[model samples]
Target: MMQTALQVLDREYLEARCSLVELGAAFDRVDRASDHEENAGEFNDSRLELLKQALGILTEESHLPNRAERLLLLFSDLD
Candidate 1:
């Protein structure tokens, strides 16, 4: 169940990325028309940063169990 949830989250991450292009274009329009490039750029930058953080968390959560198992095996010889 947790794995399935992680897979869903991964899919969401991909979908979010696909939508970013269109959203960025809209931001560009605002940047051009209003001559507020910094505002638009900052908004897009913050969005991208948030997306990266979320994706990183999802990836780490998905792999954590496998990593733990591997660690256990790596130290098994010491027992």
Candidate 2:
């Protein structure tokens, strides 16, 4: 679904193409230690919140009032 969105709106929402949540998770997992790295759940949580808010704006702009509605409309034939 994300790839679909990118293919459709890549030129317009270039910034939202990457997974902001996942990128922050990766960056936050980088350890200062020699062998092991702890998951930075807090950092990733913060990023998740921010990304959720940002995603809302993108969805509104894209006119996806409720994504599930769009998905159901698109796939209702399978039912």
Candidate 3:
């Protein structure tokens, strides 16, 4: 039997909230540290681009169930 949305939320909400807060804090730290650099170019990095893309995937609202797979492919080297 599958759990309802509220049941899942009740069990996972705190952890999920903490993870998002952690991610936000990490970005804040990066921004703060980059502020003192003359040529930070924080947004120009490929890794940052990948992270933005992953965030895009996370923010999209759709019925597709392959978000995890999409994120994995986004980070994978297909060569």
CA RMSD, predictions in order:
12.2, 12.3, 1.8
Q: Please, what's the RMSD in Å of model 1?
A: 12.2
Question: TM-score-based ranking, best first?
Answer: 3, 1, 2
lDDT per residue (tens digit) for residues 25-70 in model 3:
9878778778768877453568877887899998898798889899
lDDT string, candidate 2, 1-79, tens digits: 2557657675645564466666556555542331253543323345445445554554564544666565444444564
TM-score of 3: 0.83
Question: Which runs in model 3 stand beyond 4 Å of their true positions?
Answer: 40-43
Better-scoring candidate (TM-score), 2 or 3: 3
> Cα deviation in Å at residue 47, candidate 1?
18
Which candidate wins on lDDT? 3
Over all chains combined, what TM-score does candidate 2 have? Answer: 0.25
Worst ten in a row by lDDT for model 2:
31-40
**Descending-lDDT candidate ranking:** 3, 1, 2
Backbone clashes, candidate 1? 0
- TM-score for each prediction? 0.33, 0.25, 0.83
The models' CA-based lDDT, in order, is 0.58, 0.51, 0.86
Instruction: For residues 1-79, write the lDDT of model 1, one tens digit per residue.
Output: 2568778788788787877776678656755755665554444456555445544543465634575454445445564
